[model samples]
Target: MPDSPYVAMGPRVAIRHTERNDRAEFTRLSRTSAALHHPWLTAPSTDEAFDIFMTKLERDDHEGFLVCLPETGAIAGFINVNSIVRGAFQGGTIGYGAFAPHAGHGYVSEGLGLVLAYAFGPLGLHRIEVNIQPGNEASLALVKRYGFRLEGFSPDYLYIEGAWRDHERYAITSDMFEAQG
Candidate 1:
């Protein structure tokens, strides 16, 4: 791993942009985490899927990042900022998944804080939103820990695992960022 592009760093974790070379390890991690992610999310678990995933990340509207253990450079999880809108909106939505062995270890929380700083500072984003399935307590807790407030609810907001899933929306704005401090 090279020097990280982290805007925020904790003792145990560093967050940085995803690299093309991460395909193998990311796929392996996603595969192993199937049980943990099942009804909630699905990360790219194959080379072909990773290729497509990377292509999307290369676009202006999407950014993908890897959360890694600083010492070992082992990926703990990934976060993506999608459908970024500039001009007046200056906002984006977030999606993330934690790899097995790292899940429930608080690494995701540390990494998310870094991502929020990067988004609000360098990326010039004013707001970030997350839509999570209601039953996904871990994910809800993660966002809540970061001070995102529940905004609203959407019925069949996203299609996941061949079904349209209901989602609870949460968000934090740049104004809210200061309040968190």
Candidate 2:
């Protein structure tokens, strides 16, 4: 939390499901944050792409959340838990990104913390996994602060920027998160 000056100032944010009406703002922010995201992430930046993205979230395996400042209702960032599993394995992988205006302010951390709480509580998840490109120092630090442990590395684990990219895997279970909190 000390990593963000805004965190010290007591930033208050709310997390909610991403809605279809958010299309305009979501794509706008995605386009604006292109510089911050390129090589490290890819987000829907067009009407068609967003339509497709929204469709994917309709599935039981996927859920998306937008983090916003309650006072103004402006979106700070978004997180999506994908590939959720039930029954024996109750968990999912998370992918998140911050908008340019909110990137360094720690809204991402707040949003992530809230989402993880939801996952472990209402979602009844046993664990969650996060995958980060090795060069993405910001992402790595974000996860580390949340008590996620480095599990391993995978070569060409994800395709980004038109090429296969390596990723460092990190994971945290309900027990781990609760212990740290």
Candidate 3:
């Protein structure tokens, strides 16, 4: 296992960079969580696909993080910062999933808060966005809990699960966080 840096830490969970050794557990979680992720998202469930996923994370514009229990280091979920734009924009789109066993336990929510801090602080990112299909209430609630406000709607915004899907755009900026504080 490579040395993984912890992006943020909480009492019960820690958000850390995804390591190559996470393959087996991540695949198992992905396979088991199929029911929960159906139509909404899909995670890599095989070694080959996971390898490809990791390759993408190694790119400059992407980052992958694992949300893990502090004691056992078991993965509770994952979050990806995608298409990071620096320069004047200083933003990124976020994608996340909670493993079935950990769903509804608030791990993903807590972990995401850590991701937000890391993104807005050390990463120097000004804004982060999450695009959710309107029907995915769980996803919408999660972002809303983190103080992401609805920006607008996008028709056929992303191709997912073999078809174009409409999405509601939600976003939060560092300025918003400061205002909340």
Clash count for candidate 2 is 0
Report the CA-based lDDT of candidate 1 relative to the real structure.
0.92
lDDT of 3 at 88: 96
Span of 10 residues, lowest total lDDT, candidate 1: 1-10
Instruction: Summarize candidate 1's per-residue lDDT along 47-71 as a digit string, tens digits.
Output: 9999999999999999899999978
Model 3 TM:
0.94
Could you tell me how far off, in angstroms, the CA of residue 2 lies in candidate 2 after the best superposition?
32
Backbone clash tally (model 1): 0
lDDT accuracy of residue 181 in candidate 2: 67
TM-score against native, each model: 0.95, 0.93, 0.94
Superposition error at 102 for model 2 (Å): 1.4
- The Cα error of candidate 3 at residue 58, in Å, is 0.8
Quantify all predictions' global Cα lDDT against the true fold. Answer: 0.92, 0.89, 0.91
lDDT at 102, model 1: 91
Please name the candidate that would achieve the greatest TM-score relative to the true structure.
Answer: 1
Per model, state how many residue pairs clash.
Answer: 0, 0, 0
Error of 3 at 37 (Å): 0.5
Clashing residue pairs, candidate 3? none
* Model 2 regions more than 4 Å off: 1-11
What's every prediction's RMSD, in angstroms?
Answer: 1.6, 5.3, 2.2
Report the error of model 1 at residue 36, Å: 0.6
